[model samples]
Target: MPTPLTPPSAPHWPAPVARTAVDATVALPGSKSMTNRALVLGALASAPVRVVRPLRSRDTDLMADALRALGTGVAEDGSDWLVTPGPLTGPARVDVGLAGTVMRFLPTVAALAAGEVAVDGDPRARERPMGPIITALRELGAEVDDGGRGALPFTVRGRGLVDGGPVTIDASGSSQLVSGLLLAAPRFAKGVEVRHEGPPVPSTPHLAMTVRMLREAGAGVETGENVWRVAPGPLLGGERIIEPDLSNAAQFLGAALVTGGRVTVPGWPDDTVQPGDALRGLLAAMGADVSLGPDGLTVRGSGTFPGVFQGLEADLHEVGELTPVLAALAALAATPSRLTGIAHLRGHETDRLAALVTEINALGGDVRELPDGLEIRPRPLHGGVFHTYDDHRMVMAAAVLGLAVPGVEVENPETVGKTLPDFTGLWTDLVRTA
Candidate 1:
């Protein structure tokens, strides 16, 4: 039997062990990133738009609710959302609820509203970085009252129009700074030109995803060396189908890697700007046989070449979200692995680096936190409570480890609701069938 998932306030939930090699096909939810982006663009369009296979999770739902609060119409049509753009008027309250995308992206949309909007979220949400986007907004001629904190619990005083033009921001903290500005750019009187002047932006794939989606919405976007420009124009509203979340698929495929079995994820997109597309290369480097065909993307493994037999040195700056799963796999690898160029992970849902190091170490594995990444030296892991720190990725990572190592308990297992609410159930079903 699978362990009972605990409530957020519960002490912990024991992670179930897979007694045998896992061999199952798991279908995953729609992409949270794509779903939210589509919602934002749909809300900005002049006519009604349709979003098919939208991820119905905490983050996406929060985005939909926030848009509804801002006078946008988001109604369900079976598995799709029919978004109708309306006059941007608001005396609204937005609860971002620890969703970084909502917190970062919606502020720009809110600035286009005609009234005051107050935005806040979970206590931890207040600690996440927002200054870069906020400062950039103020510089771009929007009135925002952050009370000098530059984070959340701020009020946006919108004047119904933004006098947007060229602006420069330090996006070293996050690529969302540029994306947030660009998403709202097309509505600006002068459009917007954004220049980044700081460390190399982490998660560049996410930035590209933002840009591609904007272009598809009929927005003119020019992206070059560390700069992005969007011309003011009407966003053409139409139907869009969200791709299955490859980031979540990584966890299932990683199960195959660790268990020496095979797992195939259907509906894998041949081309996508999702940062998770990097998984094909990353997993292949770890010695899995990865094949993408008309049927799906299949990852096959056996004991002969299980995980990176030799240690891996990888730069995950563009795909930092995959760090937790990679870190877990590295712990069980035959050789040590060094993952670098992801210092920005320190600013994610939790300080992911610190959380990974602590949780893995607590389970008797050797993982050292680097300033910019992690060094995992393979070690035999036992079982103990793995603290999730309210991060959905941490919950999934711990479940992956539990497949091989018994008695691993996961705290805040409910946190997976943020992105993959049915994570535990899907994992249990797959393991049982295997």
Candidate 2:
């Protein structure tokens, strides 16, 4: 197994403070979600595929390496990735590296291999919920030996095929559970019919992304009220251009709202299944003038600090990934905000809800943790250390707060490399130009 990434000696990074309203155009990297999904589909394609402008972050890299270990050829062609599909063989070791996508999405792909595939990851990856997928994969005729742990550090004894048919799972914990099954279903002997039996699945947009991408690859897919079916067929290989990660754009756009500045992210898709696209509406609700045009998505803040924006009251069930930045903005709002319908965040990189509450309150903010979400009442926030808990989004939240609250030191800021490697650099540029 490969060694886990190590943090630098200096763990605390003092976040940049914005002295003026930030007015800049930030071009972000490709979507990590789309990039990883594309890698999976490309590897499963019948022909060579090219992925254009894919994110080169830790999470996406792990996906590429995992596919390579399964005998797929992933090569870099300039800024693009050329994926050559090969016979899916195993007896390989996969290190998931604390990436939720890797730990959840790759096992089904491994199941299509001919031999044993051992999967493990960072310590936290072992604590994540894997039971639902494990149970569902077994029901679909894959032998997964987790030593009864039902999590990571398991082995999938592949038989070169999976008899995928109807399998039910409680995907309430994560939408990835559903996406993982559907992505590899095209190769299953009987394809797959995934039916969710428990609570409403979080991050529904991500599921839409999976279905759309599958159809784009020429796979037959059908969706119903609470179920999805992918017919066994060939996934076509072709060029796919990934859009900018709008989720990563959250902090930059939130900078506009917090500092009463203007920020725009180019290459914003008019229509996207990425949950980050919801930021347009969410940021607008918080009093930012949002517009999408030839210049991409532009967010103009109404006013700077002391010029209060309205608090937000909404259910972020569909876009739970944007919770941290939105929560940070809520803490800086003029009124109280109630964000609900996101209990599933408890199983994310960390218990995001608890982390947000703890970190925000540590800076002397008033945040109440609810059963499913967070309630933020605007309070006078002071400078203090904001703990990231090794979650990338946590680093983003701290950056947003640092723009308004001085002396906000962030611990383990390097964790942002999970999705955006140049996060600190980009943030400093935006703030410096402010």
Candidate 3:
């Protein structure tokens, strides 16, 4: 039985005060979304897929469930997973929670089924983009309902003899559209070659994650990080462990920089491929005592930072996901700073650029919205009701800001459950005291 997930309304926050420096070691969770996508891809591969550290998050869990529905044998061995692929006998039913990954990826997962597979997700997930992939699937002869303007509540019929074709996907909304079709292509009678031409493809790193997982699964894929080609090939089971999330590391890094806290995030991959590493350079510019250790990095925030310039200027194409937190930091800075290369922020959990402009300005900040990012001048943020717009990142962006400013309250703070259900507890180790 699947329970419907209605994001509790936008949350409100409490006022925060400048806290004394705290030091702590945080055990960040594996990226649930990444792990699940990799798991599904691995199930369709040709090697003994061994996932190193997979996510137990809600979205990734949905991916696992979907895999089970397709008859893949997946089990956990200590901290790793051994996935054994089986032929998909679907026409199955899938329920994806508010996880956007499941909603997006399941359509392709549907393509691997023997008959029609009905995939449903949380209302929010349902509302997200599926049209591009749905349309692509139809173009590839997978018999799917377009849902009128690129909507969901559709079906994928994988009867037989369906061959991949040349199709242009409107990836302007999500790069997952491209990844889903790419991964599903190899299973088609013929392979799929994708052409991307919208919004320049957001979070290309995430797409890279998908491609890497596909490669590990014995998929013959060719793409220059964006455009992709997947051909029919042998897929088998293997073992794998996911890398620690670089996105979560950003907040801890910001915490260390904002409050001079000493935080250690172990379990980091040495050959990490996440694009969120732009934080290191950003923190250094903001005047933090930062260094990468053999295990992880250490950041010590000294208030005497942000020497001259009072701000920073950099195109964070690589670390676009961290824009919200970085925007918060810039607003809390001594002077104005501009962030660019984030036009795609508009399409995230919420219209991030608009949300940032509205919320920060509402709190008496002299912040302006950019086509790509935010231009924030030093402004005192007072305690006011800030909404999360049912997006986890917004909640965290506000929470991070709350730590730096007095009277910054975040309502409906529980939306972090998408990935971090225990954030409030996690931060209690260093927040709200002194």
C-alpha lDDT score of every prediction, in listed order? 0.89, 0.92, 0.71
lDDT of 3 by residue, 1-434 (tens): 11213344544457354457657677787876568777767767655577777766666767888888877777877877777777777768788766667777777767767877777765556567777788788888778865575665666776744678687887867777887887767777778888987667776777888788777667788886447888887765655567777787777667766675566777666566577656678877887777777868676676432221236777876567788788877777666788888887665566778888888888888878777778888876776767666667777778777776667777677777777777777776656432
Per-model TM-score, in order, reads: 0.96, 0.97, 0.88
lDDT string for model 2 (123-150, tens) is: 8898899999999999999999999998
Error of 2 at 267 (Å): 0.7
Off by over 4 Å in 3: 1-18, 46-50, 73-82, 303-310, 432-434
Q: Who is ahead in lDDT, 1 or 3?
A: 1
Q: What is the TM-score ranking, best to worst? A: 2, 1, 3
Global CA lDDT computed for model 2: 0.92
- Please identify which of the two predictions, 2 or 3, would achieve the higher lDDT against the true structure: 2
Off by over 4 Å in 2: 1-9, 304-307
